[model samples]
Target: MILALDVHYKDDGSAKSVGVLFNLKDSQPKEILVAYLEETDEYIPGEFYKRELLCLLKIVEKVSMHDLEAIVIDGYVYIDNEKRFGLGGYLWQTLNEQIPIIGVAKNFYHGNNETVKQIYRGKSKKPLYISSVGLELDTASDFITQMPGEFRIPHLLKQLDTITKEK
Candidate 1:
């Protein structure tokens, strides 16, 4: 199964992390997991993983590691050309580098070229930035480009975002 994850922060110092499991061939999620974190690490500039990684870990506990083909996060895996560990990278390490983690971001990270791939979907000229660990950059980009969607963001991914934001 391929899992996509996203986190929504609330003003009360809480957060909701949502995970959607789907096959590459499917357009819909097979299972959706939601984790409510009563308190999360305060966001630290240049160290975003500290605030969101725990939320992701909470949702990850709902699934078996062996069954995951890859995990998609809503941020970058590598932060720059030198390949610093981002949220997805930290998650990969926490999992002992066993499962692949794909970081899909809506915006470009400046000075990042060696590890980032820009993919445009549908008729949208805007591209989605893609990065990863445990998988070739080209392979990871192909997965995102070919995912079942007619728009810039995959249908299942947008659904996952909505799930995280819903009250």
Candidate 2:
């Protein structure tokens, strides 16, 4: 089973952010994990990760690490060799290392668009970039493209996104 996770922030309030998880079996999602920030808490002392990371960790804790095949994260990673580790790094560190990881972001470093990226679902298409644990950029894109689904977005992640907010 493969897992796809994503986070989207609400502009009106920080508490409105949503975290999404998609459990895939045979290239199709069989489970979904949705985490949201309902209220802001006092900032935790950290330069890379903030209160948002705290809430995200709570969501990560819900997964049963044993059954997972690979975990697909929803954003970019800023690794600092000097810092030892930070929030983004910790999020994955908390997970079972037996399962591999992949991080997909809608937007990446500025001017990174030189690398062609496109998500095709029926007639609609969108651009995406992915940084995975063991896979290269080309391999990551190929993995997402091969996922069997009718939507441009992965079926599970898309479903969780809709459920997290009023639409």
Candidate 3:
């Protein structure tokens, strides 16, 4: 199974929603699911990080964390010991070999090389940033191509994000 996850937060830093696109089979469309915590506070740096971990843990516990293909997180992850920090890396460290994580971010600031990089909407624009962490898989471009929309956000995940704010 393939799990495509997009975690979105409010400007103030609260965890607004967590959109998930899952594929139980290889030759099938993805299933959309949204997990939202109604009562939450502003996303302070330390608080946000802790809450983020809790949110992910809750989602995993709600479902089956066994026999999973991948958990694709949307954000940056710095592996090297450089002067930088990453959102996904924190999760990776927390998971601590529990589950394999694949970081598929929209944009990248580091001047480095990636296994997968390509433009989504425009052909003239620079490629998007899609890298892996625990699981060494090359499905970055494939995920973007599978998204049923014309924007950076994926179709199922985007709807999940929108519905999360409806309340």
Candidate 4:
């Protein structure tokens, strides 16, 4: 199964994470899992993984690692051409690199053009910045490109964002 994850933070310092499990070709999620935290790390610029990684880890524990083909995160695997670790990268490492991770970022990270592929979807002129670990860059980009959607974000990913933000 492929899992897509997203996290939303509340003003009270609490957080909710949502995961959508599905096959690559599926247009809909097979299972939707959620995890919540009473308090979370404060967002620190240039160290975003610190704030969000725990939220992802909490949701990830709800599923079996052996069954996971890859995990998609709403961020970057590598933040720069030098291959710095991002939220997805930290998750990949925390899993001991057993499962692949694909990072789909709506905004480009400067100096990441060499490592990330810019993929355009639907009628959106802007591209989705794609990065990965434990899989070839092109292969990761292709997977995101093939995800079902009529807009820039894939259906399941967009669904996860909505689910995570629910009160």
Q: In terms of lDDT, which candidate is strongest?
A: 1
Number of clashing residue pairs in every model? 0, 0, 1, 0
Model 4: runs farther than 4 Å from truth? none
Worst 10 residues of 4 by lDDT: 108-117
lDDT of 1 by residue, 1-167 (tens): 99999999999999999999999978889999988989888989998898998999998989999999999999999998998999999999999999999999999888887889999999999999999999999999999998998999988898898889999
CA lDDT, every model vs. true structure: 0.93, 0.53, 0.55, 0.92
Candidate 2 residues 28-120, lDDT tens each? Answer: 345556566756555545453565566566556677767665666655443322423333345556553455556555654454343324455
RMSD of 3: 4.3
> What stretches of model 2 exceed 4 Å from their correct place?
7-29, 34-38, 41-49, 78-90, 96-98, 111-125, 135-138
lDDT of 3: 0.55
Over all chains combined, what TM-score does candidate 1 have? 0.98
Who wins the TM-score comparison? 1
TM-score per candidate, in order? 0.98, 0.62, 0.64, 0.98
Candidate 3 lDDT over 2-97, as tens digits, reads 565555566554554454546633332355555666545555753445556666655555556674666766655543336133556676677676
TM-score of 3: 0.64
Superposition TM-score, candidate 4 onto the true structure: 0.98
Ranking by lDDT: 1, 4, 3, 2
